[model samples]
Target: MTLTRRSFIAATSAATGLIATPAILRAQGKLALRMGHPHPESDSWQDVALWMNETLNEQSNGEITLQVFPNGLLGNDPTMINSVRAGSLDIALTGNPFFTSLAPELNVLDLPFLFRDRDHVARVLDGEIGDRLRRNFDGTGLHALAVWETGWRHVTNSRRPVVEPADIKGLKIRTTPNPAHIEAFRLLGAVPTPMAFTELFTALEMGAVDGQENPTTLILNSRFYEAQKYLSLTQHAFTASPLVTNADKLAAMGEDQRNLLIATAQEGAKRQRAMNAEREQSSLEALKAEGMEAVEAPDREAFRAIVAGPVQATFAAEFGSDLIDQINAA
Candidate 1:
């Protein structure tokens, strides 16, 4: 059978056909795990969340039911990760700069124009480099279950459209509070104001920051157009959210259950990436309908030329140039 994102979701949603009664389920004592993320329920992470929840509920015969908390209900990115590490939360899907904020080495992947496209990104992240980054969770209180693409990061502003490299100069842009992100924009000539994702909309509306960088899925889903005017398809970098669980909690699960959970996570990751790609194409039109103006061919090469050297140098000095070479070679 074909396994498109929509098909996968439909399959999973119907997975609970043989679900047990609440009383019987209560007696059976399910895992009742909590999974939290900062994105809206309409975002890719939530798509993954819903799929995993239904799949686990069916596959485990209701012994494992994930209680998902979306829209930062459990907390913001760092708080969610910290909760997972402390064993207070079962899982969290963390976006860039959040994962990089905790593990500085992973910041190398977010450098401007590093990923050529989604295929190149999946190749690198699902290969040796991805394994290396995931392994960094070892000895930390967290266990990395899977990595999913949130999609290609773009540029949006309440000011002028980012048509060229020079257009970004002096405009205060909101960035994730990761060193690499802040430094990359600084090198690209924007004043990078790092802040929590929860505060971004208000910041833009208040003119606290003239712009922010995020994927089109997020920009449109979160309705950033209400606060910003222009959307530029920079596709400068890729956004990835790592599915993480508390090390101790995950280690205590039975081998079968652990394997099942990982399998479900992989399935969700695959579907989520495909869904994000499809959503990006449609969301551009949705954003325009909501009053966002799209700028065409915003000198992607020019943006890359200006930021590549300094940003790559920053990464090389911090993570060793050899690693950068390895990723480029990947």
Candidate 2:
């Protein structure tokens, strides 16, 4: 059955009210968990999902399995997250920015020029700083399983190469509805249009928006180079995919089942992060090979000078600088 976004959400919303649970138990006594993500099946999100399914199925002796939905078939990131929270969906994998409204403190992760490199990001997310951030998910109806990597975001536009802060001025850049992202672009003098990822390619192709920002893997997989002419290695911010499940769903499982789920998720997170890091440069080269005008070195320090200070200050004033301070110290 082909389900439109409206129908899908309506069905899931109705399921939330009508069904006491997500109906994980299927015929022949198998428990099938439904997992959805916004990325394509070829992306790391699906890769990890499949791995978890196989591993869990093997470990559980076919007692448990996963039914995967990729390419936003369930809905956009926020919609899938709402489904997970409302108990209509079993699990969702989404970038951290989408969770900020549920736990506003998560906005810290999206701040521009936040981490020095992938190593810094690993340190922050694997250490005490990661624990503090995940704790914010409590009471939000979603339980964080693990944080996976999405790599650093860069700018791709039809206008021109974004070599410096001035080059981004007045470009209609499509950004996630993340306050930090929108504000950073606004500060850089670009008009940031907060749009859903599903609508982004058409928006760029139709010229509704001039360009967008995302990791290289996504840009290549989505073929943004078809619409955008320039690829700037802005490395503006790092995005983390927090794989989460409904708290109720987790509680419904047996103790052993719950433990198995958490253990498998964390294991998958580590493998996915390593896969993403290893593919980062190769993905960039692939995009360039596909004819993207790659700006190998943008004036990142100059861009940071304009964006980081004020953005961090605004965030600090609103959320208190504890998370940011801790991340920096880490």
Candidate 3:
């Protein structure tokens, strides 16, 4: 399930059988495009973005050139999303949970323990539920091309190990500004504090927050191990990042180029998800080597049993029982 960057690019290039240098594309009306995300350069998504850029450049015979912005250099999720909507930026890859601020329907995905694992996530996001979520972007002036992965989220803290639901009580935990997640954590007896990822390490180091939750890729790449001593494999929720673009911008690209972008992005997401799944164990081991202890086993059912009723009730009232039920049934 693991794929190296070089091998990914080689496979994409070989599959397309269409190759051209950037210089050649520049001569043939190259369209300069840009995509941004919040993760550091080491994130699998970043590599996939770069891979998509190169594939598009060659696939379009240099008619399309994509520039990638990593580490929030372009902007955070909200900022980049606004820029893309304004047509000032080309594309973005961000978690759907964050998009709830704009489109509340996205909250359905952030529900705790909503997805069993990566395959379940893929099943939910690749089926009708996924299509409906993608189309929901139109109201926000964005077009979603493919839904990507951020893997499952786990907990890390500087205080002590978290192996039981009671162990989390009174601890200030960091979370994205999603109501469902915040409410879920609150129901778990933890004080949920929403903040930007860029400020997380300093927050943890300064004791601004006791712990945070994120995927293994982010925990390792962002070096959260330096400030947090313990990691619990909670796998409470999986993050789905939609690779999107401005609706108007996509329309202007014409049929062929637009299709190529979508195709390359989907392929890139496939490889990126594979790379993340492959890296989970190695990344955890690396974190341990770097001095962070892993609470390898936790009582998932206990955690779920406490939060399930309240979260599901809240989601049903806000998003309708049918929507939540559909996701569970899927």
Candidate 4:
């Protein structure tokens, strides 16, 4: 039988009760892991982290313990990533775009307008493209456990509704220090300011940055809408976060333990995607209730056209024209 969302939830609920099953306890010993992400405890990323912790603990019969540090408790994404690389941290869930700084070839995933939707993103990442990206981590001292999708990113600002490319003119938009993002917003006529995720709320509230772009789930969870009144449904980019582990730590685990971890992470990814989709659909209502003016602009195509040229020029040499052609075709 096909597992609908309801069935999946029911199955997970049933599985939760099996936490103390003897069979799970015999295969995997008690293990503790520290995982970090920059978002707050209320964010979907944190929710997924908790889900992974619960699922792993249950599946391993309380043998595996996951401690999650949310809200940049272990520093920012880059810092957490470096910590994992150095083996100071056991695991992390981080944005894929940031990986571009470490492995430039991975930047192919960051290509603007590359993903048409969630299904398209999944197809590429779960297929050959994902395997190749995983191989890039082989010598980097880290293991890519799973790639999970974050919802499509949109724009939120205190400035005004962004109906067209020109509407963003002169707005200082806070972006992750990812070059692709900076360039994409620059093409949209905004002065894209790269800032750490921790600094964004203050930046928005203090008027240091006039706006920022993120998915609906993030904006709502981060409470950015409380400070910024305008939300533009640009859906300009779709994002993924990698569930990573210290290579040595993963290598030390027995084959059964390793398989369990990967399987639990995959389940966590599935749960996260479903939770994000549900939150995205309902979040607008919450935002509206909070007095934020949500605008659905009709000119997404115009914004896409503006960034297409710059994205191609920026990564044409690395991605090659053929791959770009294929992604665009899809």
Best by TM-score: 2
**Residue 170: error of model 4 in Å?**
1.0
Select the stronger candidate by TM-score from 2 and 3: 2
Quickly count the clashes in candidate 3: 1
The TM-score measured for candidate 3 stands at 0.90
lDDT of the candidates, in the order given:
0.80, 0.87, 0.82, 0.78
lDDT digits (tens) for residues 284-312 of candidate 4? 78888898888776488898899967887
TM-score for each prediction?
0.90, 0.92, 0.90, 0.88
Which has the better lDDT: candidate 2, or candidate 3? 2
Question: Candidate 4, clashing residue pairs?
Answer: none
- Relative to the unseen true structure, what is the C-alpha lDDT of residue 79 in candidate 2, on a scale of 0 to 100? 90
> Which is superior by TM-score, 3 or 4?
3
lDDT of 3 by residue, 1-330 (tens): 333445344434442232122211223556777677888778888788878877997998878877666777666778878877777677888887778888888888888888876777887888888888777887788888888888899999989899999999999999999888899899988999998776788899999999999987789999999899999999988888888888876887768888998899888878988999999999999999999989989998999998877887887887788877888787
Kindly indicate the candidate among 2 and 4 with the higher lDDT: 2
**Candidate 2 lDDT over residue span 1-330, tens digit each:** 322333345445544343445546655756778888887756777788878988999998988887677777778889989988988888899888889988988899999999998889999988888898899999999999999977799999998898999999999999988899999999999999998787888899999999999999999888888998899999999998899999987998888788999999999999999888877899999998889999989999999999999999999999898878888988
Q: Where does the lowest 10-residue lDDT sum fall in candidate 2? A: 1-10
Q: How close is candidate 2 to the true structure, as a TM-score?
A: 0.92
Best by lDDT: 2
Per-residue lDDT, model 4, residue 21, is 34
